[model samples]
Target: MTDILDSTAAGTTRGAVSSLFPATIGRFEAPEDRALIDGLSRWVEQHFREQLGQRPSCHVYVETLPAEIVALIDRLRDSPVIRELIVRQVPAGSGFEPMKHTDELYISHYNKDRGGDQGLFDRHYDGNLRFLSSSMVVRALIYLQSDASYKVVFGDSRVEKAFTTYDFGLLDFHRELHWVEGNYTPGGPQRILLKCNYLVTAPGAGARGRFALAANTAVFYVVKAAMEYSKSPRTPAQKAVGHLCNLFRRLNIVHPLVPLAAIAASAIGVAVLAYVVVTP
Candidate 1:
């Protein structure tokens, strides 16, 4: 039951960036190895169980996926439309090679009584911390098993839709604000989802690019640390991409204005830096 939104497949025309949001270029069910994903999911659960015991939420990370899954994801990554949508329209660093595969795989497990999902009731973004790299952190979600009760909520109007097993979803990790819904069931059936995080390096513009990357990363951590400790419980350092968006509430900025403020600040900083570099 591939939920294809339109006829656009790999050959879909690239849509304009400005008009792309809320547009579903592709949404379809793809073939998956259910048994393999099941084994993987159970393995992940047991791994977390050993460490954390039977908790309400938990997850495990891996550097690789079953060969079959990887092959499918690789095909999706090769899609020119997906590449342009995720890489070209974002603030990715322009130097390092694009499509560099990292040893990063996330398997999230959520059950009624045991599993780990932190922001179950709250909307949040997904990402990892990168040091001194202006890379666009993008993730494509593949639902291995999702309960009928759960939905991934997004969009300006807070649209929500249930995720079916084998359903694939794409979102801008850095820009889109989304979260899981229907986690209140404490003793319901278990659910699992696989996430692949990929990095795209921007075309490095010599020293300027290097400086920008370093500066951007530095600012991110500084602001992150300042805001992180003020709100919810923190995660492991490696996993703590620092919930930077939560800082918006603490700063009293309206939810809708958060992105605008970030963009404005970035533009101003770049302008100031450029003036300094050129005025000599």
Candidate 2:
């Protein structure tokens, strides 16, 4: 493992990826099967364009991934280093996410020229919001195609490391503030990344973890119910409310405060009505 240290403005040393990234897992090695890599790349292109009618600019969650892709994920997840990290993420061993395997599997495409979802390329950390509340997340990034100039920045001092095709990076998404360092302009090259997240089930000991789990669960079911409500027959006003709920879900802003806001509004309305009645 190569550990290069850089001196930042504060005169403190910012270490290389190895310093910040908890585990390097393995040295840089090309995958043995080039054909499998090519096949996976082709499948990703086709699935997004032909099957889903989505442009390469959009991020996609792969709900029904191909068997080969599934096998690939299995192999990566089962890597010795990854297994150890999983144990480290949740030391108890018994607690696991609702999904036994992967919490989520998704792919991202970034074009230098495209405008949509470009904010992802900005300097920021993955799972920053989720991690703030004691939820530790690990994301494995497998690059199908990459630009060596583009880098993943780490640490408060901001050390950068470039990536290449078939390069695999394991990150502590919850702990580090990492981001892409380069511009993707229209009519320029594109970057395709396949990311799989192994979500740590909220640790059983902390109230924070438990609350995060409960809040996530509640938001999930509320969003699910909103979808069902949208589909079912309803009065125009009810339909409008359902659509509003669905919008909130899509934005991921539905929190305890939302329901509390509604309650407060209703209580105020009731109080006004009672006052008017008494005055009359």
Candidate 3:
């Protein structure tokens, strides 16, 4: 202790950046229920599992956030600290928007055999995956089942390209977290980590400036996506709306199974015509 104090007194301070980028991974004790804004996450995860049956769809992944956390986010979005982090402006053609990070991200394993559609699957849903060229995604994950189990690696662009296959090991890390710190860009910034809960803090990673910033950025995108996916359509007229949504598919407008409910008016029209002809 005295030696450490002496070093501090000598002004041998440490760096505030790690090889990691925007943010770092950590775990804080969530509230008892673990349900809140994440109601959407559960819904989205389950829906994908049911429809895709564990196919390797880039669209399927899971993030589980509990409620007391929601309050934390609501508070941060309005906080001045976050105000400093957001980009107020960018080039018009950048196809990007600045966002604020005010919430903790959830990273839960989503094995179709393990947790395809649990009870909370059917609920409000609102979220989307962030991707570049529709091929890659910036992802964050944590293993609740174990602590200090394994690390999530983010290599330099050269390293990532050289590697073609990776072991999809079971996420058994507890109190430990995993995250990636690269975008679709080449060698932009790479600092990902697999660490204990203590290592996941903004300041902790920020202290070393490794994965913290990237992790922070990824969390922001996840929150925004979730908010968008959970909103429900406000009417029973979803049939018309659903058709409108599928317009780009160019499926036959009305095939044998368009559903009686969907064309109730048309059904009524046909019935009236038949009745009049028979009476005549």
lDDT of each: 0.45, 0.47, 0.26
lDDT of 1 by residue, 1-280 (tens): 1011222322333332222223122333333445555655566456555533444233333325557656544554454444554443433233322222332344334432211234444555433232224444455565655567777776533556777665556664444566666644556545666554444343444554445445434544454344334323345542343343344322322343455477589789999999999997
TM-scores for all candidates: the values are 0.50, 0.53, 0.23
Sort order, lDDT high to low: 2, 1, 3
Best to worst by TM-score, what's the order? Answer: 2, 1, 3
**For candidate 2, what is the total of clashing residue pairs?**
5
User: Candidates 2 and 3: which is better by lDDT?
Assistant: 2
For model 1, give the 10-residue run with minimal summed lDDT.
1-10
Clashing pairs in 2: 112-184, 112-185, 112-186, 113-185, 113-186
Runs of candidate 3 with Cα error greater than 4 angstroms are: 1-23, 60-150, 154-280
Candidate 3, residue 227: the lDDT equals 27
**Highest TM-score scorer:** 2
Between candidates 1 and 3, the one scoring higher on lDDT is: 1
